[model samples]
Target: MELDFSNIKVVGFDADDTLWVNETYFREAEEKFAALLENYETKNKVDQELFKMEMNNLELYGYGIKGFMLSMIESAMELSNNNVPPETITEILNLGKEMITRPVELLQGVEEVLQKLARKYRLIVLTKGDLLDQERKLERSGLTRYFHHVEVLSDKKEENYKNLLDHLEIKTNEFLMIGNSLKSDVLPIMNIGAKAVHVPFHTTWAHEHIAPEEHDNSHLTLNTLSEILKYLE
Candidate 1:
């Protein structure tokens, strides 16, 4: 079914993977982490356990590199039966630091899409992660000038989006969200009477994956951020 965006006045963009590179770094870090613990567990097992650890600690730690770092440390301890070297723990800390300090790499056509859309729509960023990390990326992105507001959310659940839209006085009908994660960005926004566009990135975290049957084909899914121009611009 073809959906209408004619009434959409506010365009929300997801920061990680949508506008800039993110998941790829996490993948790379996971590889390094697996290698660090290869002696204690297979890479596959290490990856699985780490994801479980992150989920277990999500409520306590929230979402961010810090939480991921702690999860890695804990996973390493469990996988190694608490025999993992202290140096391995230090390496995990360094991995998180490296991710935080890495320069933001904007995805293809991000700036052009933002610039064009900003002219006619209220463009804002609605992303969930470490607040400071997101802010740092936005500042380094050099695209901050195009956005009217920047929000770093704790999570992207339906209520979170609803609350933010209400707080910003943006009517649900007038809001449109674009992002990489179908679970976080597309489904929840669509559920809350808002429009959503899925612009998939090359890599997705395991936690963000959803079964194909879970989504209906009502919303738009673009191959790249620039393709959105045909609909909105």
Candidate 2:
């Protein structure tokens, strides 16, 4: 879908996979965790158990480092007969902290595209993650100056998007959401009568990916963020 930026005011973006490298770090941490748990359970069993814990926690805690840390601790305790060493738990917690504080790596063309778009639109970052972690990444990326508003949300739902639009005093048709996750970024915005552009990332966490049936209307998918430039032109 072509976007005519002549009248568009606000452009919202997802932070993690949309602007920088995120999933790869999480995947690396998960592999290290699996290695640690291998002594107690088989790799496949550990993965399944961890997934189950994460799914359950999503309902209770939603998504973020807090939920992730809880899931890791719970999975370790469950798989190890409640005998997980304190030192090992400390190690995992340290690893999670490291993942959050690691240097930011902006995705290809992200800086360039953001720089270009900032000149024309009121850019806002709407990301869901641990508050401090998300803020740290934005500060480190040096892209914070390009955005007029930064929203670190607990979850990306239709109501959240609607509220953001209301708070900004922008109509649904005047806003466009750009991000990686179809389920979190695209579907919710589309559901509220806004336009969404999905910039597909190479790696996605299991929880981030969505089934095709969920994508219905007012959504466009692109392999690269740079493709947005062509449409806007």
User: What's the lDDT for residue 79 in model 1?
Assistant: 98
Q: Which consecutive 10 residues in model 1 have the weakest lDDT in total?
A: 1-10
What is model 1's C-alpha RMSD?
A: 1.0
Instruction: Provide the TM-score for each candidate, comma-separated.
Output: 0.97, 0.94
Residues 1-233, model 2: lDDT tens digits: 65555566788989998999988887788888898888899888987898899999887877776678789889999999999999889988987888877899999999889889888888999999878888888999999899999998878999998987898898988888999998899888888988889998888888877776766645678989988877654
Give the alpha carbon lDDT tens digit for every residue of 1-233 in model 1. 36789999999999999999998999999999999998999999999999999999999999889899999999999999999999999999999999999999999899999989999999999999989888999999999999999999999999999999999999999999999999999999999999999998989888999999999878898899999999998
Provide the global lDDT of candidate 2 against the true structure: 0.86
What Cα-based lDDT does every candidate model obtain? 0.94, 0.86
Candidate 2 deviant stretches above 4 angstroms = 1-6
Q: Judged by lDDT, which candidate is best?
A: 1
